[model samples]
Target: MDIKNKVALVTGGGTGIGRATSIALASRGAIVAVNYSRSKSEAEETVQWIRSEGGRAVAVQANVSLDREVRGMVATVVEQLGTVDLLVNNASITQHILLDDLEGATEEIWDELYGVNVKGMFFCARAVAPFMKSNKQGSIVNVGSIAGLTGAGSSLPYAVSKAAVHGLTKSLARALAPEISVSSVAPGAVATRWWEGREEQMNHLSPNLLLKRIAQPEDIAKMICAMLEQESMTGQILTVDSGQTL
Candidate 1:
C-alpha cells in the first residue's frame, strides 16, 4: 500500500479521528473522499483544509447505516475519483447510558448503535469489495474501540456494537484475503469531541494510563495509516490507547 495516487474513502470524515485520517491519507498522496452523515460543514472544512495543504479531497454525504446509501456512496466516489483503494470504516455512534442499567440499554439503543457502529462498517466493506477485488489489491481499517475488548464504554449497547465491529473485521479479513487485507484499530480514550463536557473526567483518566496522557486524534490517525500501509498484517486489531488498558 504505497498510498500514493490511491483512492481512499473515510466514513464519518467530518470530525475527530475520521477527519484526521482523511487528512493523513491525503497527505500521503491518496485522493480522499470524506464521508459524512450530517456534518456537512465540517466535512467541507476538512476538504478545504486538505486542498489548502496541496492534497486532493472531496466531501461525500451518506448515512452509512443504510445499505443503499453505502453502495451509493461508493459509486459516487468511484465516479469522481476512479476506484476505492483504501477504506477507513470510521463511522460510529454511541449513547450515554449507565452500564448496569439494562432498561437503559433498550432495543432502540442496541439497534441504533449496531446499525451505524457494526452493520454500517460491513455494508461499506461489501460495497467497496468489488472495486478492490477488480484491482486485485486493497486495504480496510475498521475503527474499533478498546471498549469492545473490555465491554466498557459510554453505554452497554455501544460497547457491544464495537465488539461486533472487531468480530466483523476478522471475518472480512478472511473473506477478502489474497486480494484485500482487513484489520482494526481499537483506540482507547482520545481527546476528541466525544468528551466535550467531560474534560475533567478525561483529565482524571489520563494520569492513570501508563503514558499519563490522553491520545490525540492524530495519534489514532497515525496508527490507522500504519495499519493501511502494513503489507504483512491482516485480521489484526491494533490498539492506540495511551496505555489506558494496560
Candidate 2:
C-alpha cells in the first residue's frame, strides 16, 4: 500500500526502533502519531523532527498494557490524525536478570514484562483492528526480538514475551487477512538504550555473531517499511538479526 498521506500510529515511539520507525514512516509521507508512555519529551522531539522534515506528525501518550488506555490512544489518534492505517506495536520492557537468577525472575517481573510485551501488543492490535477493518486496508507491524526465535535474551521472561508476540502476529494475520496485513520484525541485539550497561556483554558476543556487530535501530526500521509496502506478505516474522541466528 502507498503510505503517502496515510495515518500511522507507533507505540513507544519515543526512542530506539520506534523513534526510527516514526521518522521513516513520516518520510514516506505518512501522518505519524508518535506514542510514548513516559518519554513525552522524546516523543515531542520525534514529532518536531518529522515536522522539520516537512512531514505531518503528532505526539501521543498511552500505556499499551491497559486496554482502556490503548482504546483511548487509538481514539485520540483517529480524532487527531484520522483513523490509523498503520499500527506498529513497539512498546516493550525487559529486565537484565541472568538466566541463573531464577529467584530474580519473580511474579512481578513476569507480569511487567508480559504486560508490556505480550498483552500490550495484543491490546493495541485489538484496539486498531476495527478502524483498519472499516477502511478495508491497513498494516500492522509488531516489533519482536531474535531472542524469541532462539529462546534467549537478557531475561527468560523477555524472551517468552516476544515469543508470544510472534504467535500473536500469526494469529492476527489469519484473523485479519485480505484487509489488514499483520507481520513482525524480530531484531537481534539492537543498539538501543536497553543495552546501556551491557555493552561489554554485547562486545564479547559480537565476534560469535555472523555479522560481527549489533543492529542499529534504523536497520529494523527499514525492514518494517519494506513489510508495509508489501501487499501479499503476512503472518511472517522477518528477523533483522545481522545473521546472529546463524
Candidate 3:
C-alpha cells in the first residue's frame, strides 16, 4: 500500500472530489489516470496543476457507466501508466427533488442517475478488479455519501445509489480480502460545485456538526490518501462527516 511511484485511477477526476483526490495522489508521487466523462477542460487543468507541482498525471476521458469505455480506460491506464495499483471510485450523479415531488422523477431520470451512481460504480470496480487480482495487491476506494446512511436531506434516488455503493464496497471488500483492500469514504456535505448555491442549507446543518462547518474537497482527499497508503484497514466505511450525524 505504499503509494510511492504507484499508479492510481480516479473516476470523475475532472472536478470536485475526484479532482482533489487525483491531485493528492499525484503530489505523493503516484502517477494518476484522471478519468472523466465531460469536464474535459477542467480535467486537463487538474493534470496541468499536478505537472506544475512536479507530479506526473494524465487526463483520460471515460464514462464509467459504459462497459466499453471503462474497459478502454483501464487498458489505457495500464498501457500508458504501466499499472493501476489504486482506484478511487468517485464518479456519481444526483437529481435533487423532494420526496413529495416523486412523481416528477421520471423513469429516464431514475435510469440516468442509477446508471452512473450505482451501476457505473460496479463496472469501474469490476474493470479494475482483474488488474489488482493479477498483481495480488491493490486498493479500491469507493466514495459514498452520508445520505446513504441516514437518507436525511439528499435526494432519495441519489441516496439509494450511494447506499448501493456502500453495499458494493463491503461486498467487494469481503470478496477481495487479503489481496485487495476495498473500503469506502462516505462524506457529508462538502463545498463542491455540486452544492454551489446551497450554502444556506449546508451551513444550517453545519452548526449541529461537531466541526460546525462543511468539508472542503481537500479534507476528503487527505482521508482517501490515508486509505490508499494504509493497507492495515479494510472492509471499513470511513465517514469524514465532521460528526454531523452523530
Indicate which candidate wins on lDDT. Answer: 1
Native-to-model Cα distance after best TM-score fit, residue 203 in candidate 1, in Å: 0.7
Tell me the tens digit of each residue's lDDT in model 3 across 1-246. Answer: 889898999999979999999999988889998998988999999999999999999999988889899999999999998888899999998887886678867788788888998888888888888888889899989999998898754577888788888998889888888889989999998989987788788768778889888899999999999998887988888899999778
> For residues 16-54, could you state the per-residue lDDT of candidate 1 as single tens digits?
999999998988899999999999999999999999999
Backbone clashes in model 3: 0
Q: Is candidate 2 or candidate 3 better by lDDT?
A: 2
Q: Which ten residues in a row have the lowest lDDT in candidate 3?
A: 151-160
Regions of model 1 farther than 4 Å from truth = none
What lDDT does each candidate get?
0.95, 0.92, 0.89
Evaluated at residue 50, the lDDT of candidate 3 is: 95
Error of 2 at 49 (Å): 0.7
Selected candidate, larger TM-score, 1 vs 3: 1
Candidate 3 lDDT at 196 equals 73
RMSD, model 2, all Cα superposed? 0.9
A best-first ranking of the candidates according to their TM-score comes to 1, 2, 3
Lowest-sum lDDT 10-residue window in model 2: 197-206
**On residues 1-246, what C-alpha lDDT tens digit does candidate 2 reach at each position?**
998999999999979999999999999999999999999999999999999999999998888999999999999999997799999999999998887789999999999999999999999999999999999999999999988999888899999899999999999999998899999999998888987887898788788888888888998899998898889899999989878888
TM-score of candidate 3 to 2 decimals: 0.96
